[model samples]
Target: MINIWAIGMVIALIVTTIIVSIMGKRATANTADFYLAGRKVGFFTNASAICGDYFSAASFLGVAAAVYASGLDGAWFAAGFGAAFVPVVLFMASPIRRFGEYTIPDFLFARYGQSHRARIIGVVMVQLISIFYLAPQMVGAGTTWNVLVGQGLFGLSPYATGVWVVVLIMTLYVALGGMKGTTWNQLIQFWVLFTAMILVVIMGIVNGVGYSDSVAKNSEKPLLNPGKVTVAKLMEGEPGKRLYDVNQKNMTPEAFAKVQAVVDKGDPTAEVNILVPQKNKLHPERAMMFNEPGHRYSALDQFSMVLALVLGTAGLPHVMNRYYTNPSGKSARFTTVWVLGFVALFYMMSQYVGAIARQIIPPEVAKDPELMKLTVDGLLLKADQVMPVMGKIFAGEFGLGYVAAGAFAAMFSTIGGLLMASAASWGHDIYENYVNPHAEEWKRVLVGKIAVVGMATLSLLVGLGIPAAGLDKAYPALIAMMVTWAFSVSASAFVPTLLASIWWKKTTEKGALAGMFSGGFGAIFFIVMNILKETKAVAPDSFFATLGTLTFPVLITVPLSFAVIFIVSITDKKLPANVEQIWMRIHGTAAERRERRMQQMVLQPEQK
Candidate 1:
């Protein structure tokens, strides 16, 4: 069975690639060009590209899915994601660009002076976050592949094929065009995603009205509740179990007693249904009873997508980086405003489409072989697949093709930006500056290109390996968790380094190193501990009760780093003596520099 939908998507991707390649040639090939597109990006263009690169699989598919899954609480993820950028804009963005470094590590090292200790730890944070981030993209690739090609095309597993294909395409694009190609691709893809989303929203509203009217006339709750529900996954383990093989079966005796008590309290003679695996007496094979008809449907009409557009665009990294490509800091700020307007229009449309999917896709359809299994024994279905599933429903074969193509483009654009950013850190901050200071410009650029290819390949392998290793198919959740770690690391390390570089004169190399290390390492430690406790690797019997919450713990670490850095720097008392000169360069007026440059340009032209 040749799926016309899959074929259409392939065609769309090819068209997007050709168009971006043509425009990308406009960017000159040099270190500056490779890294920052020679700092000449205009406002509208960069802003659009930012929106494209920023949206990712999470924002496009994930947000819609989350809204559908959690009812009201899932909205918090989108809100947190978007609002995170406000602090970045007010505090980090302008100063970071002004500091004139390639990676977060580069900025830190530059501000703190060369310390091997800081470099090693910074690399660790980067690798951890990037690897974790890469896993989700890979998992998403598998997911989309499964939906589009798996069932329709061949007997091969959709999950395996999807991961490889998504990684393969992203690798090729990043390897070939570098940053210039990546930016152009992102800019175009952003528009496609936005357009698709708009169509979805419009159709959704129309669907909502029809569903709502039908329910109102019939005195029913059709649109109000999709009526699907399932049990949430609970961590399980036993004493003496290894970390990796802590079987989901094998709950402790105490846990069994607790469950029996609950069962007895309900009714002494009532027959209790438990799906337990044969070996584990306490733990069950399938714990929760599922109900497909009772899951809550979305109240899409009530959401404010307009507010989301504003904050969401601001928080994206790929979008923030685009401003650095602009000629001046002022141009970068202007580009952000442009992004706000463009993204707002597009996001509203996407939201509408997601809403439409909720209205049209029937509750019973989830159990159908071809449709999403939204309710699994009392547990809600994953929300991330809503947009893609909707595409299959409304537009039928054609819509599926369009949505998949757009999604692939979206992934490519964002992944390429990340690869390039990561590569720069390795090449410029680690290799060239620290390992080989005398390296030629051409060699440096070549090294970066090679590093980009290497990173992409490694990420591909890692992404594919994640599910194979039996970490569970919680790919989206894991990826989201890892990105938060990245954000936390950046928030802690970069926040201090940035402030010190631009504002504080007393910041010493020792203090910068301490802050970066402590903040980065401390967060990792806390997250790992929480995860272990959840899995019952650290404690078996009372897993949830044993695991301490992380939010307050994370807050404690940030200040600890800040304090360490400040104290260490003062004690060392050997700070950068020319700190004032460095500050002048970073914080100096652009008008003053431009005025001097204009005078020179005029004088040189007359002399020639």
Candidate 2:
């Protein structure tokens, strides 16, 4: 009953984390060391850490799950996630590194003529985005825990137990080790998870699961989703048939018989979980097939979701913060390039893993009682469980152990970075600058540690509350869906203004403030309303109904923020007096050029 191999692997991971934290602890002596790892992380090391940080619960579990559950439409998550970094490399990476700031808010303050208003607004947006992003990781922790551990201690459910354990580990290590520890661990974490995924893909091919062949085989049947409907709704339709006919046509005999048994008892309120033909949400007139494109997004949403994923990468505070760790602008650019390649390969293999599970899981689910609870006629109840379940199917306990450890690495690495980012925004950006400008170095570091624990506590509470909010039931893979929402928020809140700040001299502090408020709050409002609509908490008609349908608001919010900043700056026309000087620094003009030349001169003299 106990999985000794799985437990052993987990213990090994924990031991490695502890060892890395101790190493980081010895290295961290000042705020600079704690937050940016002494600003000396190499391109390759930082690149690997960036992959670990970027590949959250959403990337690790959600990408493959999405492919498994929704077919080709789901592959867009990976495509969008990978494409996001391109803009970062072309637009943000070099300029941000050249700007030389500890956080996004720090950049905003200097760019906008040292306005506290801009700094404060930046902090608000950072924390808001971090919270939205962190919540999914918490939910993911619970979701993965349900599959790997399968049970809870004390009075907690399996989900809650997972959240608690992962959150505590993140808080402890991040607080103890700082960025130096986190960077090295992330570098290590990326490879562990990356290697595990490689093994799963290789093993699948060796076991007769070809990528093209597996996809073709799975697409042969009408794509069906296992869902529940009320008996009352099923009993309504036409003179001869009604709504009941639609479901009955798709349900298997065994599933239909179960529904009939409930109907015979005359219970209109009863619910039945039955397989229904998956509808093409994008093109309702088209058929829903596993290899097809219209399974999830509409014509409008396709573009909207793509924009959210692409622009959103530049906006993530935790991710943006990593750019500061680079020693130079060139290093930052190199890191982004490396990250793109690593994530692209990881995503490709993950989709194949999903396809293999699609072909293999159902047959095995019937034979294993433990696997039964995770699936419905071999289809996963929550698609996020695909990786570990597929692991067990592929190689029993040993395979499960490898994938489970990877899942843990994914969650811990990203969550740890988020915890550190939140700490820096609060402790370094706010407390160090405003709360105690004269505080000792020890006091400042202590505040950062305190912030880490506080964020970890908040994440734990969010983990427990996800199911209570009905978010778990509202989406097929909530881990991925929630993460996309966070991306939408960050893109809406940060990217437009950041671009304007670096490129346009007229981007006044007032304009930045107005833009942040409009875009940041607008994204959050749209996401909340959509969630409410999905959970059946709010019923909308006409205009509200159309707005509620938008799952990714970046299509509207990103442009709106850009427009607001442009119009407001034109009207205000109040540029900073030192605007030209700051421009040179940001764009590597005379000021930055002089600095670089002087640095080269000093090095040449030493060499002579």
Candidate 3:
């Protein structure tokens, strides 16, 4: 059954993109205009656009899904995400803009005495972080498509169809309109996502599914505990294993048996849910509170997750590029303030939506014949589907379509920004600097467009392969988890180097290079090891498992990166000769730089 309403929303998105592209085309004639929107973005407009880029599908769908699946631990993800802006405002924003670079790599190259090595490393790190970040947005796109359209096209799976369509649309949006178009589109997207979440919350409350009621109902049910379960095959001598969850042991033996019997008859390779006794057992009938911890993370994991989110935000390449779009340092600071406010509002509503979802569609109802038929595989809602399921329940099909549009907006807005960042890095940092140092403005812009298309195609191919790679199954609510790895890499590879370069005049190019390689590779290595362990290629209790868990490798890699940079800089005495001049450029006021330039201009005739 085709959904006319959903199709209408997609058409609306297409029309809006065309109009924005036309407008952006008028202003996008030079590199500055294309990459930074002429550096004239207003405070609120930039702020809103930053929110759109920052939120992504992880914030739109993943945060709520995390909350629904993991209780309070999920809410912490939102908190860390929101809190990250504080460090940006305090440490990065003003100086980054004052330095006045086209991209993060641009800043690094300038600060390191115009080294091509710095530029190349910066581009590599940017692409690494951007690609990791881009994948989740693609996954979210696919998940949204499956729930909304629920159909395949030309023999492609719904997931593949979504990835292809979104990538195609966003590639055009970035390649045609450039940064100006992406910023304007993001401004509109943020509001759409914000309003959709607000409406869901309001409707949920009006329908007697408010926060308090949600908490009450959630507390009355035993939480599902996930682990490996061995199942006996009907055929003798055959055995199988699966990931399954059994509820708290508070349930009576008879009740437990009934649930187990149902599970025994189901597919042994699939996830199964059963009831058991509660851990506390003090009040067997009373359930755990909604705010309780230990649902998903151990104490150590919680701390690690928070650490990754807080530090990672500072290092994200796409986000850092947005700060460069500000007209001045003051404007950049103001943008961060506004981003904090916007992010806080979104997260608060998102968690409430997650809680409301639990109330509207409880775990017990997951097995109901009618509800089962409505889900992806005639089973419980996937973690990413929590928010959409709530939409379908609270509103009708139209509501589902509306929310689906909002979800796509979230993915498209972020993807556009990411593609633009990647293009700028490739065109300006690599091509202009290395391939054609004397390239004209038009030539540079052409190269950027080509880079945009290339990067988008690469990301699309990777996104389409996610389901086939079994990533969606291994990490059920993959948005947050996959995003965290990106964050981990960013924080480990870039944060220490970025902070040191900005604040430490002693930082040498060698130190920065060493730190970037060590930190970036370390994070990637651990993340891959963790994934292998997750897929059961390695033993859980092995030493490698200790380093490779879903919890970020940031804790190890970040400090190691910092230490490497500090030690290398002190040991290598070959600092940039113009350290004082660069310091003034980065730390001095904009007015000072302007005055210096004017004075230099005034003395030029005498010197000649």
Candidate that would win on TM-score:
2
For candidate 3, the per-residue lDDT at 254 reads: 44
* Every candidate's lDDT: 0.56, 0.86, 0.81
lDDT tens readout by residue for model 3, 1-608 = 55677778867977897689878987778999999999999889999999889889999999998887666777887887878788789899999999999999999899998888988998999999999999999999888888777787899998888998899899888888989988999998888878878878888878776776676767776554222233432122423312122232443454445446756676555443432122322234455445676555555667777888899988898888998889899999989889989988888888888777766764534444445544322223477887766666667667776788789889988998899999999998898888998999999999999999999999998898777777775765689888988989999999999999999989999999999999999999988988877666678899877766655787789999999999999999678888877898898887887787788799998899
Model 3 local distance difference test score: 0.81
User: Candidate 2, residue 423: CA error in Å?
Assistant: 0.5
Instruction: Give stretches of model 1 more than 4 Å off.
Output: 18-28, 113-124, 151-156, 209-321, 342-359, 363-369, 372-380, 469-482, 533-548, 551-553, 591-608
Per-model TM-score versus the true fold: 0.74, 0.94, 0.89
- lDDT per residue as tens, model 2, 1-608: 44666778877997899899988998778999999999999999999999999988898889898888888877888789878899999999999998899999999999988889898889899888888898988888887777777889788998999899898888888999999999999988888888878878887888887878878988987787777788887777683454467556755565467668888888888986666577888668766899988776777777888799999989999899999999999899999899889977888887787776788887787689888776655678788988888877888999888888888899888998898899999999899999999999889999999999998888888788989999887888788888999999999999999999988888988888888889999999999888887888876664565677888898899999999999999999998888876887788844667986688799998999
What range of 10 consecutive residues in model 1 has the weakest lDDT sum?
A: 289-298
Sort all candidates by lDDT, best to worst: 2, 3, 1
What tens-digit string does per-residue lDDT give for candidate 1 at 334-357?
A: 776676566455544443443334
Local lDDT at 342 for model 2: 91
Better of 1 and 2 by lDDT: 2
Off by over 4 Å in 2: 232-268, 540-543, 589-592, 595-608
- Model 3: which ten-residue window has the lowest total lDDT? 234-243
